[model samples]
Target chain A: MDRRDFLRLGSAAFTTATFFPQLSFAGTLPHGWLNGFKDNQGRYGVAYIDQKLQAEVLFHTPLRLHGIYKHPTRDLIVAPARRPDTELYVFDVTTKSIKVITADEGRHFYGHGQFNQDGTLYFTTENAYDEERGMVGVYDVTQGFKRIAEWSSGGIGPHQMRLYKNRLIIANGGILTHPDTGRATLNMDDMAPNLTYIDITTGQITQQFSLSEDLQHLSIRHIDVDDNGIVYMGLQDQVKNRRDLPLVWKTNGDTLDMMDEPVEGWEIFNGYIGSVSTNTHGLCVASPRGGCAHIWDQTGTTYIKQKDVCGVSKNADGSFILTSGEGIVRDLDGQNQRHALHFDNHCQAV
Target chain B: MKRFFLFSFLLLSPIAVQAAPSMQEMSLKVTEEFILPAYDDFAKQAHAQSELWGETCDAEKLKPAFQKTSDAWAKVQHINFGPITSLLRRDRLYHWPERRNSISKSINKSLADKDPASLDLDKFASTSVALQGLPALERLLYSDGLLDGDFACKLGHTIALNIEKIATGTDKDWQEALVNIKEGIAHPIYFESMDEVAIRFFTEMLAGFQMITDQKIALPLSSSLKKANGKRAEGWRSNRSTRYIQQNSLALMAMAKPFMSFMPDDVEKQVVAQFTVFARAANALPLSIKDGVKDEEGRAKIKKFLDETRTTRNLLVQTFTKHLGLTVGFNSLDGD
Candidate 1:
């Protein structure tokens, strides 16, 4: 659909009395945005929002999902349960059928995964909790999503991964946690977070970059890459009351460089960054803790003020679309809509 | 026609509405009545303790002052936002649940150093947080041979002075935060609205409860009798664990009073009754947290207190946010 058609549909939907207006042209929309949410009645579901901004709940489950991924060449979408959760939900958009994939024994999903260029293989960052190490669980998409192999993630607490060229760029959060202790970080004092690039063909780590000694407690948790191949990372600080620390960094060729703190200071983020996305505008990093999203570009940095804002993704026109826990969908162009759902951390333009 | 007109009039009639407390009013009440006072008390007690230590290293005179300072901290520790969170001051003031013997190792290193510059206040301020807080002070006062030498006494005095500096800075910072909160939308960084202020306060309050239940209580009260480790309790070395819990419960109750006017009458009643039961249980604890976790009879009492606290926390979570028309978001509360 073109921009004009999208605007027309948006206007028609805006006049409806209910919060979510059903669009007749939803099926005709080419692309959709997928996210996890909890409804007003406290039901967990994955929502699919089409090009015309019509949203539909694909399926409901007991697990609270985090990151979502759409198969590169298929109608399948996978939503992984957050860390320490063992379930991964696979939904086929065309057939409206769902498949539940369970993590291997003694391992759990870290809530993020990526598909290979041809879409034949799927890899998910996982925790080998019993062994106190991180692993990348590989699935053979051609063979009914079988768990074919596992590779060392090169560090502890491997979260969010991205496929760049022939390598998988993984954020090793470095914080140690176990299912027995819930989500508490067991090794904050000695955490050494890093960004690891693994060669997909060899299953070996090709390059890894870590922060300086002073920044050992900064857990690199989320990642996004701009069009120019600059990798942006969102960080979470394990130590409290250290608001002077930077929460965003970008890869500079072979090393990691901390981004300049905004004029307003790093305290505004409250020491956590939930999701990171890139668009024509720049790198958009969301901090649900600070209730805002910041766009960092070559010119400077600008922020959008929204309560509990986390999920962010790029629109076709190069603008950014943001979702919040208050059930609000917003864009940089000032279009706003609310639904009876509380959006989770990450959203993907499927 | 007359009956029809009367029915329409009744349908559109204005009903009497009970005005819920405004965000501005709630913020003012909480800040002025609870937060500021607690910070002031903490600063005062810390200053007194520092002065007493400076005058004499006598344990008998210094111990009571240390208790007063700790009690004041327990009252204000729940207010974890704003100025207190600026410079790692909170951890520097009382780093607890110490890991890998960090405190003792730092202390031993400091004690072995012969240079006079080692005991300098400016240099000590830059030391590991483990050696700059109440836990270190507790070790100095309660441990057997730590405070025998002049260097150890000087070290103790330096730590006390460091804590007082943090306490004073925090108190001053909160004064500025109060102005920002009162400014509401006018303030540049503190808060955007009164609702935002209330949400932050409520979230921190819930976090304080979780900390107490998870670390202060559950860590010491292990799963089974054989696994019980009394040393795990906060302030166990000073034998002030039970007293700290009591102070914390009382402080939380005091902080909660401002929100009562916003709740429905039935909810308010239930909350008050639950808090009463929780406070009474905290007060009735018969032994220190160290002994309570290890002894069978004392363990039962501590367990009952823990259960009461959990029940009260649940009641607040279910009612307080709903009545306040506020949501502590899942993403904001527990995002990866």
Candidate 2:
């Protein structure tokens, strides 16, 4: 299809009316299917989470809004200040106003922004978008908007971040290369790419491992590490082969050694891994309809595909609040697949 | 030197601060969807379906038999990442409309067990199954999904299939299967290809199988494919596209030795076909060809075996097929 036609069709703005029937596809699941929420066939120009899906005009932005975190100390949702900066946005969920913090840092944003156990420190990654910019970073979430204890994206597209006590696992999905253009999406093939680790306090390069074979396409987008220290990242493999990219990798905490690697084209996508998080012992990653959600365990590696699912987050009651381009959730896991919280625009989550 | 140091320091600072080291083995979020008891379960079942074709006296029996096989293929789609798979993987397992899975399985089994010298009526009937469904790729592009491609998948298939007809046909018809395979193997050489059906479907399908097992990564062979390509320089491979090209090459290689070893006629011509398939697969490797590389070493070993088959015949075929089996790797039998 031509770009004009695609933009015309894809930019229709996600809507509940457009998606209500989609949720019925996986009707057996208590939480609605994620595929039901995605544009499914959209060309992926920009993505947004309409609070209208859950509420009316709560907060809105046009940064293609990747990662947004709920503030711990106050009523705020902290998303990347923008796609290209450490610019963190502190938006009030209650008041419906937003502040772009870290605006001074001109780095490109990926997603998955969060605070340390103390809630005082914030961590996230930004792509250099190639060497034109520096990669991702880890900063402190302060009373005044600021990015502290920052870092580079390593290669070109350093994406999300995970904080583990003295250590941090960066989900650096190299997303710079464009498939249609047939160029280095991340312009990282000239350099090495991998999960780079450093001791938070010492700021030393503890160790790094590269998805050496496929170059920069092994974008480590989102991450979740268990108590045992095994790390996982939602991968968007660069190439479009059944055998490469759009994968997930795992590593042991203590050794920082890789326990799992992405199967080239092993999953349903060749796109970005949006948001990945864990509740209790369970973990999930969004393939952006690269498609669906993979919920797995740390110890035995038990996994379940909440097929066509996304926005997997833990609710206050130990349940999940899954947001889709369509609005749906598996509030209690009973499998009704009901459309919850109606909306008129694209619906992601806070 | 001072200026370089300053540049490097500024460059390294954020990477040092913002980036957290990644774990070498990340437990993937979606691998759970792909856990299945087998990777080729549908293929296996399809093989079974192929065997049962026309065995019964009743047509009712025949339809159900085909339906059962078709059902398995349907399940495979639900498991596969995307709605459509490339013709190559599709070829590995046949699919028919009415009773595809079963009928294809019947053909494969009969062929696998058939002896040319003792061939019978049953063998011909079972092995006669054809590819049925939404027309092959060539038709899709020119007819439906595409507008501007030099050729689509079916055009390629038709060329190969016609070549086979010419080589193997009776004195008047002039049709043959081996000839078809050879030309098909060489087609890419003449054409500078553009796009291919992406592999997201493969990953998603594999992930679906993995889900049943709920494992970290979907397929065991993933590690091997990654490891094989890992050591090479990124260069042109930095582009995300090369994955499909690499897989296409590997799939062709798997067919190379079998085509050669199974050669029925002039040793020279048969060896030529075998070499062609092997070379095509190798040339398609995504990395720019390099000397003194490990890939070169492996290719050399396979090529040597292919060449040896010219004189040694059966020994080379066994050796090559064994190699193909090893290279493709294994998945759980359940499609997991």
Candidate 3:
């Protein structure tokens, strides 16, 4: 390399070095390195995926909202909130107004609530920070917030619940992992796993299941059900003492299941797969932190990723539309230009 | 050998401070640029997205899984650092558009010419450097004291510096840095074509990164993950290690780019289409597995007890059919 070549190489080396800065002292999670947040942003509000970002601020406080349920026919948006207050905010999108929904003064939630297929009744999972007393409350989908049903998660903390007809398929993410602290700080070894299938109207545990081993620490939090009766769920593992696990699993509500181990290439990126949805082809899991859509065979078989993909939604068109980490909504058909959106409140499709 | 080189460039001038006799040159240049401030209608949209993804985030508590991969690689960087570092550089740098494009174009060009030196990873070619001396400019721009002249500016400073550094590619060694930088950007670029998952997943992408060397990936993927069965659930399986394959496989594809003229259209369409479809499905996978599962067994004697409840999603038949229909073109199965 001559002088000009020297300048170019020197510049290149410097760029490489600066761009790929050495990980200094892994020192207990460099909060400094993490910035440029998408999919969700700005004050306390509810985020949803649409043609672009549609942010409607419910509360002015710092409490983080967890759930946003759309009224089946009405343009009403139901948003469940946590911390500071356990209030659920209801908004009429067409009118662009708001209302608050809640269970009681004592309970707040770590997850969300959903409307019935008819949009008459709604269900929200409440953690209450007390595992023994944790419950899922039912409210009037429309009028005055009426409390109907409240059930238990056994031991697992229920953050998300998917209503499969009468069967409320809930992901009881066993332990309560804090958002204030990072993932490396939870204990999973002593966890108790149980998947309770309750007939929403009856509130009876018809069928129960377990992983049968060392994964009790795995929190069954998010779930998706297809046209078939198959319940596709997702998990979050508790980091015990000083260790963490990023392995994902799948089963057709059976004890015998396939653990979708991270690809040999992704062991280190043992991604926390979040939110699962299945198309005609296979299942798609979001590694929110990893920023990629890890698509695996329906049986938890093969993991083929579109990498760094996030906030996926079945588009108005038959294909799926997902938000990229770069705040672009890319069509599955591979269109020339993505419908670029951002969270002016928070960007990207959520 | 771990080498360190630090050369500071002189961007500021001493003559400006020394030169006396200052003139009252208060001439103003006003440019009314199109301005739709973020605080306008975008705030609500931004907030809605955060809560929506956050509420929906954690399909599988992936941070634990994602962190595990990064943790292991961090431990191994003490040795060959090739694959691991390549992955780290990819994640850390690719987040920037210019850096990402530059890295991709450089790699693409290098692959075309087969000459790695064409990459331009300049440390100083940046927007951040121009903004550094903006304290004086700040007092002039916003007519003073009206905007946050402290913390936000500091944050802007950090973002600029970070992006510039990423643009320069100066933080890591340059042995195979070209390929490393390209792969770093490409992996995410491929996977993240859709939604920006939650924060926890980003950590996993970083952690799940594995070191793929030329010799190792020469074999590419061993067996279809679906093919592995009961006994396949052994040693390496449980660990759920993530890999960074497809560099050479992709490079090989890039080389065949021009030669693709000879092949039929469906063949080419099926190839890219299948890979992308596979990529989409792969992207949604692990998080589904991680969040889709639960350990209610309490981790003790829960293993001996078994529960079998079957609920199959029939739509999957179509997905599998699509997989079968597409020509994946993996060399692992030759006899067929």
| Candidate topping lDDT | 1
TM-score comparison, 1 vs 3, better candidate = 1
Q: Write the per-residue lDDT of candidate 1 for residues A42-152, one digit (tens) a residue.
A: 557677766655456555667788888888988788877888889887776665567889999999999999999999999999999878899999999998789999999
A1-350 in candidate 2: lDDT tens per residue? 34464344334433101111011112121221111111223211122222222221223233334445555555545656334334455654344445555434334455456566766766666544324443435565565455555665454455556667777656555444322111223232232346767566665656666765433445565666666666766655333323333366577544333324333234434344555666666666654444355555455443333333445665444444555433344443543232322211112233
Better of 2 and 3 by DockQ: 2
Please provide TM-scores, in order, for all candidate models, with all chains considered together: 0.84, 0.42, 0.43
State the iRMSD of every prediction, in order shown: 10.6, 21.7, 23.8
* Predictions in order: lDDT: 0.80, 0.37, 0.36
Give lDDT: candidate 1, residue A244: 71
lDDT of 1 by residue, B1-336 (tens): 232223223334554545556777778778888888999999999999999998999887899999999999999876667677766788788776666667887788888884568667778777788899888998889888888789888889999999999999989977887876676543454566788788878887877776667667766765546656787777877889898899999988888887876778888899999999999999888568888778888888977887788788778787776676557876887788
Question: What is the descending DockQ order?
Answer: 1, 2, 3
Residues B1-336, model 3: lDDT tens digits = 011112111111122221211111100000001001111112233233223323333313322322232232222221212222332333332211111123224322333453222222233223232222112112112222322334333332332333334322322232133332333322232222111111121112222221121111101111222211221111112232122122212322232232222234554464455444433433332221211122222211111110100001112122222322211111100000
All candidates in order of lDDT, best leading: 1, 2, 3
On DockQ, the candidate that comes out on top is: 1
Q: Give the lDDT of residue A291 in candidate 1.
A: 83
